[model samples]
Target: MKFKDYYQALGLERGASEADIKKAYRKLAHQYHPDVSKDPQGEEKFKALAEAYATLKDPEKRAAYDNLGQRSSGEQFTPPPDWQQRYKTDAAGFDDVDLADIFAAFSQAGGRQRQDMPRPGQDYEIAAWVTLEQIFRGGEIEVGAELPEYDQNGLPHRVAHVFKITIPNGAADGQRLRLAGQGGHGVNGGRAGDLYVVLAVQPHPLYRVSGRDLYLDLPLAPWEAVLGGNIEIPTLAGPVALNIKPGTLAGQKLRLAKRGLGNRDGSTGALYAVVRIDVPNQVSPREQVLYEQLAANSTFQPRAHFATGAGA
Candidate 1:
């Protein structure tokens, strides 16, 4: 067989780090994936990338491959005399088995394994993000997944499919949804593997999420903070009124009990409205007169500490 430069296939150097290898593989996989790639040779390129990733991702396999030294393309190649004894027993992980067919084809071409037996397909995992609104309402989410398919002639190709997944209320980050028989196709009538969607909640500009709790900045006018009143506030459910107490200071947090994210067990978390007092940057003539009158009449002394320190 012709020599294959695994590192060159991944566009990496001989001493590339594990993380670098994975990054390169993922980029190439997305670009050459049969389902989404517009390139006519996408399938072949994907296969090559998969083989390179599979061989290099494992420490033992990588070391063994590296021991063979540099090789030129199109040159006749053979493994070392003790290759089978040294590396044959090393196995690839489930995640890297997407290209098992290519490896099997090589083995079969060399007359190693029985051709009649069937091999099960490989499982796949992909990272996905869900909107905070979707989690709050809890409904169906459409996820587009690209996967490899095969023609009647047994040639491999890629296809994209939309899967409707039901997201539960209060679905937190790092959650996973498993779909059975949705991953890679099996060989010779073997059953297909599973697909896993690892989920993360997208960041929201209005609120910060922590577990089931939600925190938001509640901006209040200086007079509103001092006088206290019912203020309209926004929540995941909708706008609601919150009663603020008199003399409420900045940075004070007000809790809306059981108003945060809902759980599957019928429980809900509390929402915290953190107080932030705002002052007018430019005061009108009337406002300035009112502020001057209040400053003369009001007994509130905000600089009392500084006065006491100066006195001491």
Candidate 2:
């Protein structure tokens, strides 16, 4: 359960005035709202955007969240000290908004099984760039969401909130997660739109992802390519050992089935090891002599037929 910081999620300064918060929310909401935009993740961004605004728009609720000491450590967004103080022990002026309703927002729009159904409010969405490791195993995240604000007269307002989102194990890039009732405000008992989360996994230094499979560039020594042995390689799951077959060559890919990134239909991806032979920059004289001998015996021709076909 990641804590969501509405202010940070909405990309606002903590001390931003209500007017500033409202303006920002409108700009972003219009840009990301699914009904109006097509950001691939517009709906999810829109819902989160709206929910953030809803939370921060109300001074009392925002104040409660703000003072709860709900800190943000990447994915640990929480309220500030005395968070309980923000809520009234008993319903007073806000019987319209209560804790149960807030939690229900978590399921307002439902799951992948049903997104087209009319919701209480408009849904919002956004993309999150995460590390490959986080995808291999479940983890939490912090998202900066922008929300709208308004006056008693029903005018728009501005403010930002940060929220922590949970990432499930074996999640794929572009995969979505729904947070109900996190979308637009309900009207006449209708539920608000659900908040959807789409993941954008960043490329790892040692891993290249293709579908559910991961590829690694494993540098091999000249001897290792000829003699073959186990070598260290990195994968989305973690570092692992890959066996090098004797006489291995460049462009050769070996598969570690089901060792990739996400599940195929329901499990996990596969891992492929791409072999690359390394040439020593500072070779020993003895090694250089050996290479010279090897080169003498090498009958390999790289571009043997270009001379015959001179069309260009």
Of the candidates shown, which would achieve the greatest lDDT relative to the real structure?
1
Quickly count the clashes in candidate 1. 3
Query: Model 1 over residues 1-312: C-alpha lDDT tens digits?
Result: 345788999999999999999999999999999779999689689978888998889776677668767887555555454533333422321122223343433342334458556767778776678878778888888888777665443433356788888888668878889999998777767899889987878899998988899999999999999999998999989999999999999999899989788887889988999999999899999999999999999997788889668752
Q: Each candidate's TM vs. the true structure?
A: 0.66, 0.54
How much lDDT does each candidate structure score? 0.77, 0.67
lDDT of 2 by residue, 190-229 (tens): 6767777778888788888887778887788878998999
Q: Which candidate should be chosen as best, given TM-score against the real structure?
A: 1
Instruction: Please give the lDDT score for candidate 2.
Output: 0.67
> What CA RMSD would you report for each candidate?
10.7, 11.6
